[model samples]
Target chain A: MTGVRRKSGSVPVSLATVAAAAEVSISTVSRIVNGQTHRASRETIERVRGAIETLGYRPNQLGRALKRGESRVVAMLTANLNNPVMATVASSAEAALRAAGYVMILCDTHDRPELQDEYLKAMRSQAVQGYILVTNVKSPGLAEFVARGEPAVFACRRNPYASGAFVGIDNVGAGADAADYLWSRGCREPAVLFPAQSSSTIEDRLAGFSMRLLELGGRCSKAEAPGLSHLDVGYEAARSLLDRASLPQGVMCLSDQIAYGAHRLFFERGLRVPDDCVMVSIDGSTLSSWLAPWLTSVRVPYHEFGRHIVDLLGEIWRGEASGERILPHAFQSDVSSDFE
Target chain B: MTGVRRKSGSVPVSLATVAAAAEVSISTVSRIVNGQTHRASRETIERVRGAIETLGYRPNQLGRALKRGESRVVAMLTANLNNPVMATVASSAEAALRAAGYVMILCDTHDRPELQDEYLKAMRSQAVQGYILVTNVKSPGLAEFVARGEPAVFACRRNPYASGAFVGIDNVGAGADAADYLWSRGCREPAVLFPAQSSSTIEDRLAGFSMRLLELGGRCSKAEAPGLSHLDVGYEAARSLLDRASLPQGVMCLSDQIAYGAHRLFFERGLRVPDDCVMVSIDGSTLSSWLAPWLTSVRVPYHEFGRHIVDLLGEIWRGEASGERILPHAFQSDVSSDFE
Candidate 1:
């Protein structure tokens, strides 16, 4: 151990080098360095200490974590950070995690399954303690990770293929609420605008809206466009709906961005909102209230999502049973006063 | 070395156990397991291999990474992930990093210096290969890290206390352009709205706007409110502005969100945009185009920021001279066409 030369000038002294000098195993040196010296003999611990001092080896915090088979790091995989709702959820979850003494590693999957799979593999290799998936993509790697009973919480979006702990508003209930509100506004013919790419959130919302609208003795037509961005999808869907014979009196946009896009098209066509058509959307994001035509939306309670998600993650860590947590939602509209 | 028993039944067999069974150092065992047998004799390598077979030790990928003192991971520290501009920058950078075979770790510093310092220390302890800071908080730990010549790229927000590679639009130039645009619209009296919490981006923009407006013979007044979110700042600033006896003919908002909030207030007061007040703002984000009143804005090239930031980070890694990369900005306004 004493006669071994340095690997090279560029390489820094490592734990392995200290272990070699001490003539002890790497874990023994690691144990001594990390102050877990209960198992080591006094002489052995002393020799390892001397080797560490002589070799100038600095123990890496990450290496120490690996030895303990855990890290205080949580990785959150977001489908699209560019979306305000997704951003709000991610930001809240990050704050909550930080308060709980964990650092969150956010990865924007960009709604691509391949990218999601890649990030999953990369994050797994880094040994993140748990995962917060705001993405619905069920990559094979994610399935295996979940099947292994790893600590994970599905936020905003859920993997339909697997049962896991989920924290989000009840999209189906929100959709029904939206339908009831629009129906009460004296809209016999209503329409829904959505993206063609389906997720559990979208499907559930659509289902609830359709079922409730039907029960209310009104039929709701749906328009969908194939696009990755909600804005483009809304624009295209609105255009498609406009090509028909007549317009729906009430419109329900699945998300705020979709509403924004559709509103832009409506403005271009000189069709004022609530004058030509009343509109309601989901995801009561700040943009929903800040932007003009102040969308009356079913608020998803995004601010509260962080605390719930982090708390659920902690429970999972404690070997608790995984379950769905449905937060409350409500109708919010600054423009409602004007209509009333 | 063989005398060391298994640490316990709960602990899985680790590298230390393999080394002890082989009567060799942990580095030797690691090297043999990783197929780096150049330094070890054939017998030593064979013994380590046999011990590995007997102990059933599965090498951890993260442990291997620590041994190499490198991980293909990049960390991005963002001030507020909820901010659309910051979100766009982060999402774009993530895609760029992924394409380059690197995974990005995003941490929302949330504009808190203590949080920024904590995240910096945590990420450094984890030994991330580099850092991408979309935040401007100059923590002492960050100062030392930058002073050490660590590979760091300042994206969108530059560090005032340190000289580092920066990738962003020229805020001063962008500000001057906004002033010119507002002035060209026949506005003699103008005002700029910004958040009270000043950063280099905000200060430089304010400087440019004030200087250019002065040169144009129009003294621009400024209103700022102490708030963390731009929306609140804009609303409060607008309220303060409206409390005065008069209003500025031309208004400039430092960010799109500020414009959004101020516009909401103006709408509440039954004032019209471009009619009652011609407005121009920075961050020609999608919302700027999608939202009504159709803000005429100085469009920052956010989508292109990712390529420039990642490439600059690569150059820094290559020991190249750190320099500022200023991307181009342009005037984008669908509303301008209507005015003309």
Candidate 2:
């Protein structure tokens, strides 16, 4: 049995108390308390208002019930925060989350599935209302866990089996797009190099590119570098490819990191990009623009994608209907023979 | 006059009831109920525990006075999440907090003091057991503002006034160490370049280097480029620094960004690092090692320093003495250099 002191005052009226008092949803209660009007019915509003008055429930998620009058914290769980792509996404996600009167709690799972599970458990333990998953690792528990009625969303990578909430570009389409672009650029025989990491994700991207290249009447050769080869795997693979008796007409790298390493090797070997060899890679990183005549690349919509994940999570928190969300990937194809 | 509901009945048991039943100090009753036990006498503990059991008085802050299984959540506030050093520190702090079974609510204030203030208010409102401030912009409210007296700790930046608890490297000493190493390597009459961002931080580092240079009988010239020149202002600064009719024999860039630009220029002009133009920087970014031949840099004590910040905050939360925590900076002098 629990009771509040009348002398000191009833336990500070909170959102939880008000939601319990009103026969309405959390988002509905939040909207009413925040003075937002739109979808709420007159009868529902009247009932909620009546409950608030009788219970003397003061809105707490605002600045008043709160001593300082603000609680705009947002918690984001990112896969591989060390990866520059995810880092870029997180940077933009914070920007958008802040613009929407929310702060972010960024958790980097280091692309470990078990660690991701631990973080999820921790988030639930803390009652974190929103979640953004940015990773390529496939975890069976993730989609189910987030889908089990929570304010959660996925970014950058999506689970094919789950439906109801995700915001990301078409990785497969992007891979195929790269292949098509390379083939169209007068390349007859193309070799694809992907670093071995996150089997599911690499497969998705590679499948997309492979499908397109085969359809475009171009021969496709695939190379998967052994061991951990994120970002720099392409360099080693490229060196080995060049040292081989014959070289493919063009090279397609999995990420900009691998491409960067390859570029260095080319420089070391007195070879220029797109001259002795035409190169293309995904992710328009900061270095891509600075490299000599610049790289022919497809820029991941990090800014938009990041915002989409956060915004979708907010929608879920606001009690939007459950479902899958796939954001479109904007392609940057301004790569000409524009090398100096 | 807050009270607890009775186990057998609905009637409330007040603090006075416990005090009367225990025949002890009302202050003692209050302290035990609130979970503070440092001042309570042993006999008083037995009396208060017995009284609380008899009267069934429940404490709010001290609610569940048992300490062993108590799980806490610490809200940590930081400015730039994208900055590698800050990112590493946060990662380490989160690990430490997690290992201790504490949830870390990380909020990025994004260099906005107003937002930082708002976040402080939010954390207070959330009733976070404690807070760890890792902000870029220093404010008066930072060192203090613990009205509820919830423990507060700082990381990275320090409270130079020596008022608040701090866990960071000795900025001045790190600067001096970098300078001493550079000069000992045949670098003479070195010029300094900084971000021109925060005068306090810039001056702190520059002063240490300048003081040491003067002590070494070498004249130090300084230049500050306005705006975000560390990244963009580099080329111009390098051009000006190098194009001068007479230039300093060596250069010390305040950051790897500045050093990268300067070195790029040096390369263009056919000058070599540590040979014709010895270059050194602080905040050892990954760019330092990945660059060809690497860069001479002063690596901030990230691992050790990060661990200390979390440990200090833990100590503060545990009701230990709260004071300034001056951490030592580990200097990595082997920053890829060739000296006589």
Candidate 3:
């Protein structure tokens, strides 16, 4: 059989080549490529694998998707893809999904509840096998989708209404850890900078940080800003907070984006991090450590979060019990106080 | 006609309601919903429009996609979504596409040629109406796809193998501008840090920058790193450059990710930015401005680039001539010396 030749005089690897080399039917190659290894004998699987390795046969996912009700496509939805933390999670999740013969479609909800519904309905109708949401809270169609016993997992953020598998770091614990670290460094006047919109993750972090700080004979204040992108909100919050005569000695930001904003404001106002104020935040993004005064953050296990989401999906597919899978977080300090 | 009530006991707006309210056939409503309005009479169109407004009918794009070969879906394939710059572009592009009744599917190619080919094949077979690629350089199947008269546009990066519409900022000009700005700020010894990959975008910028720096009577050195991500590579490059003892007065990075890495290395080594060495890069991301000693960058018109991609696709679909749409870039100086 003649392989399809390109204008550049190169032949792309095809399943036909794999089939011929393995001495198997094209359907056999397709089945194996689509992850139906159990149907084929061990010898056939090994032969196909050898052929695939030799030819570098990357199977076209769409053709296999058309053969059954399952499209072998999963969608990962987030409130905003602009968040580097979410981007990191998406990168890992996409890699995992692709490795398992599934194509991942990323949808940015832009933190709109209506857009969330629109995406869910659109993706659902497009025959996506599963969904992993980074920020989902009482989405319009989540209940019905959950009621249908569909495969779904929440990553990073959770919905109070949905009883499903959740793969994320412990926000509350991270918040408490931040308080402990800051207070140990002699930070008495502490404040939490978080989004005004109430999320389980944000609320938990704030509660943990505030309660821990308050319990330890330290005062905690709250500075809330509304919006998804934390940079602007964080800047605005820091501006207002700085305007007040009594400034917080320590600031716990909900995210790195917010912390960056505060960083800008502090620097502009002739204040240095951990010198005038100690800054701690969640989501250990690359940016968190790449500043003049590096941020002290709770490192969310983004790679593990993605892997666990995929693993939990596998567990659900295999009829295993699925409810909540909480990943761990680590406290990293780049603040000068910590070093001192 | 009765409406479909969801688990929340709320009636979701349906096409059936529109059909009944307009006293028109369901087929007519379907046609109008699918944008085949030329087939209907003026009265029918107005009635359907009125009814749609009254009933709030949101068309199910999937059913229509199945009926026609054209899908109301466009895919944007990128090397990596972890780049905040790419995220900004994707966000704006998705918003533009969604506003125009097209759902955007983001596929991260992970900067592998094989993965790029895989994503293109998968998305193509899924019946995507068009594609907007963020980083593509001589992929195996892209030439054939373009030759087939498919709607495809290159964003941020370009491929010489494929002749298609390109959408991005003037990287060459931006590079020259960076050189000019640095030279004006009294930077005689300049070093360029860029990805080693042979892409038109990177090459153009490097060429423009080096050429301009030489013309301005300033010596410019080059450091190239091989990878999709500019962060780790940038850090490594900086470490080596700083160790050389004879360091460049100004360092121009190809992207913000690279600049961030350099920022970390510089700060860790106690080198003052703009005082000891100035830092500048392209892709004006949030982190560029939000950091303490902010990154001076060439601000790519991300929103306009996204909008123009959609507009170009529309023009192509309407049988209009499409070639290239170059957006403008701005030089943002936050390297401290600029302010002085």
**Highest DockQ, which number?**
1
Residue B88 lDDT in candidate 2 = 68
Name the candidate, 2 or 3, with the larger TM-score value.
3
lDDT of 2 by residue, B200-308 (tens): 4566778888888888888777766654435444545777766664556678887666776667666667777767767777777643443433467777656555567
Whole-structure CA lDDT of model 2: 0.65
Q: If scored against the real structure, what TM-score would every candidate get?
A: 0.84, 0.71, 0.82
Clashing pairs in 1: none
Off by over 4 Å in 3: A1-67, A139-150, A333-340, B1-63, B146-149, B292-294, B333-340
Name the lDDT value of residue B53 in candidate 3: 77
Candidate 1 local lDDT, A141-245, one digit each (tens): 666556556678998888666776899888999999999999999987799999999898998899999999999999988899988789888888998999884
Which lDDT value does model 1 have at B312?
90
C-alpha lDDT score of every prediction, in listed order: 0.81, 0.65, 0.77
Best by lDDT: 1
Candidate 1 chain B worst ten-residue window by lDDT: B4-13
Model 1 misses residue A80 by how many Å?
Answer: 1.0
Selected candidate, larger DockQ, 1 vs 2: 1
iRMSD, all candidates? 5.3, 10.6, 6.1
**Tens digit of per-residue lDDT, candidate 3, span B1-340:** 4785322212445677888899998999988887899999999999999988776566644445655656677888887787777888887888888779777777887777788887777776666788888867676676665566567778888856756689987888988998998898888888888877667878888888888989999988777777666777788778777777577788998888888877777878878777788888887765565673456788787867789899988887776778888887887544443221
What is candidate 2's CAPRI-style docking category based on DockQ?
incorrect
